[model samples]
Target chain A: MQKDSFRVRAADLLDIPADIKGGLLHIEITGKREVFIENHKGILELSENEVTLNAGKETVRVLGQRLRVLAMNNNEIRLSGIIESVGFVREGSSCSQL
Target chain B: MQSAVNFVRGSVLLEVKSSYPERFFNLCARHGIEFWDMTNDGLGVFRIRMTVKNFKRIRPVARKAMCRVHIVKRCGLPFFLNRFRKRAALISGCAVFCIIAWIFTSFVWVIDIDGYAELDTARLLNELSKQGLRVGTYAPSVEMENLKNNILIDMPELSYISVNINGSHAHVTARKRTLPPEILPSELPCDIISDKDGIIHDITVKSGTPEVVRGETVTRGQILASGYVTGRAGTTITTHADAEIRARVWRKKSARMPKKYSEKVYTGREKDLYTILLFDNRIKLYINSGISYTKCDKIIKRTDLRLFGRYRLPISLERATCREYEISKASVSDETAYDSLSKGLMSSLELPEDAEVINADFITSSDEVFAYATLTAESIEPIGTKREILRNG
Candidate 1:
């Protein structure tokens, strides 16, 4: 945790984007229909209603209806459907509600 | 769309039946296997599309994930061509058609000639054929400069000639040579002579002494003006004679017409003969026997076959139509015969445009089968014609 905080402070001092400097996850959502996740580890869970992916430091879960994996490659995953909400699950903790 | 790119590179749609579908998906992603349009059916079955090459490399990943992958569909050019592998005739036909198209476009099929006046086109075509530039000749083999020079040498009447080959057509543009105007030497001494028997009605001399006056009768070959001029100090100076002499002349013409004439009456009988022409070879579609009708008119028409309404083919169809008629004798009234004879005599009397006719009279006579008429007319016309004066040393 201390190392991560020092890296974040260095990024702030240098005016660099935290996602690129710290190798953090970058998520882009378009309306309520699509979501693009970059810097992802892999898919943890996939279903018609929800999809959970492993980011570097946390787990990202997307809740939606008729959810599908539109495309997936090494570093990015694209999910598409009528998105309802998004939440995060920290290590050794249950899901944090959105 | 990515689908279009995948279709060109050959793609496969596979259905994966796995108890752990998420592990299969994550394995595919972790190994850098590109896939799209992935869907889950809640029955441990998932469908996804990927390129054929990438699909071939996903076997190990699928085995590690304990999934059964079955290709549901295959789409692309290789699979499409495999369907026609057993039909040899279609493949050969396509190859033959392509070869024929290439051969046809390499040679000249049509020859178009333009700007030719007072020169026969068939004769020029014959000359061009002799010079190795005819239809069906290979276009690339023709040496344009040499062909132009040889043609100009063979036919000097052509002032300018150009040969342009565009695709399967050869365009030949030519211009006929124009003869220069005749130059007359005005410094030489000349005299004006009377060309017909007449009485001089008017005389105007510009540069010489007048030999004949008004109301004077003159015969053919008589000089109407002299080229000798009396200059100062009694010196006789020679000059070119210029004059306009008008005279009164008489003309007579006669014509004859028959009271009974033979006219043709068609009986509505015709025969058509066809012949097929391939290049210079003529193939007669009918047997060669002389025409049955002795007194018949033949109308021949030639139609050239063309491709796509533009490229002219070497083959043509010729149709000859023979129409038959019969001759019948007919009689006319004496007044009608006389009028016809008079019209013929008037047309036969060719006069100059400036000649003014003063009086005309016709005499008519008829026998049993023939009628004759005589016409006499009087007119005033110019009578001067130039004659170069011959001087002896």
Candidate 2:
């Protein structure tokens, strides 16, 4: 985990996108209509109001209304609905990233 | 459009049932089994759409995820083609129709000529027919550029020409040469003189001074009207003479009719010949043995097969009917000859339609009869011959 954070910090210092570094998860949100998570492990939970995706050491939760998995693969999952908020929970940590 | 293409390429709607359908989707994604439009039905059943090829590849992955996959619908060309194979005649008929249409389009059926005037239409058609541009001509065999050049070379009167072949019709357009104006003799000052000796029945003067009045006896070469006119101011003006003179003329016509004549009578012997005409070539299909008819008249009829009431095929069936007649000698009585001679003399005079027949006399001789008729006809013919005016300088 320390090594991953150091790599992310190095990427940020070098003014390079973190998604290109291969270890970080890439999440793209289009307004409140859709959420695309790349470089993810699997779909951990799915429901009408929210969807939780496992992205390596982080758990990404998308909160919305009438959420559905539009498409999914091994490393990517696309969720579509009226997305209200998104939160990421790092494994073994209480710090929240939104 | 994308879904239609997918349907054409074969796609299936699938329902995956399991405790964790999400795990099944992830497994599908891992194995590159592409799917879209995923919706979760209640109680662990998920519906999705995938290509037929990808759906087949997802069986092992679904087994590993402890899920059961069921096909809800199948679509696309292959499935529709399996149904289409049952009607063999319909499919073959469509194919044959296409081939026939293609073959017929390659031939010219109707030849149309446009923008033509002052030229004999039949003569122009005859010239074009010689160049193989007539109806039923094969389009590919016709070189349009060469044909235009040939037409221009053959018809010097044509100023502009073009040959256009559209679909099954060839349109030929041409412009004829305009001739120069004519200089007529009436433009000169002349006198209208009498060409025959008769009593004047009527006289009409358009641009001349009248010299003779109606009911006056005139001899040949006598001036009926003069081009020199005296105006109201007593000035003499020279003009082109134009006049029409109708006169009461006497004509004597005679005709001799022979007492013996021969007429043709039907012999009841006939023959029929059948032939096939392909374009300009004729092939006889039936033969007659010793067709020796002394006097016979033959009639031929040709029929062509047309497609859709407009397209005429080159092939045609021709039927020739020949009827034989025999000459029989018959003797006409003197009375019959007298009657025929009178009618013959009336027609031989070629008198005017309103001509008054004054008298008819018939004289019969041996083996021949003669009839004479005197007719007074109102003739409106242009009997005035132009005479140059003598100028006294």
Top candidate on DockQ is 1
TM-score of 1: 0.65
Off by over 4 Å in 2: A1-26, A37-41, A72-78, A92-98, B117-134, B169-393
Error of 2 at B198 (Å): 27
Tell me which residue pairs clash in candidate 2: none
Model 1 stretches with alpha carbons more than 4 Å out: A1-98, B1-9, B19-46, B177-264, B287-291, B329-393
Second chain TM-score, each model: 0.70, 0.59
What is the CAPRI rating of model 2's predicted complex?
acceptable
lDDT of 2 by residue, A1-98 (tens): 24547777788889897559866788899998999888988877877787888777778888888888777766777889899888887667743647
Candidate 1 per-residue lDDT over residues B1-393, each given as its tens digit: 865666678878899999888888888888889899898778878999888888989999999999999999988866777788999999999999999988988899889999986899998999899899997899999889999999999999999999999888899999899989654478989888999998999999998889999999999999999888898789987789999999998889987888899988877899999999987889989896478887888899999998898678888999999889889999988899889888887777777788888877999999998888889988898997877887872
Give the lowest summed-lDDT range of ten residues in model 2 chain B: B369-378
True contacts kept of 2: 0.68
TM-scores of the candidates are 0.65, 0.52
lDDT on C-alpha atoms for all candidate structures: 0.88, 0.78
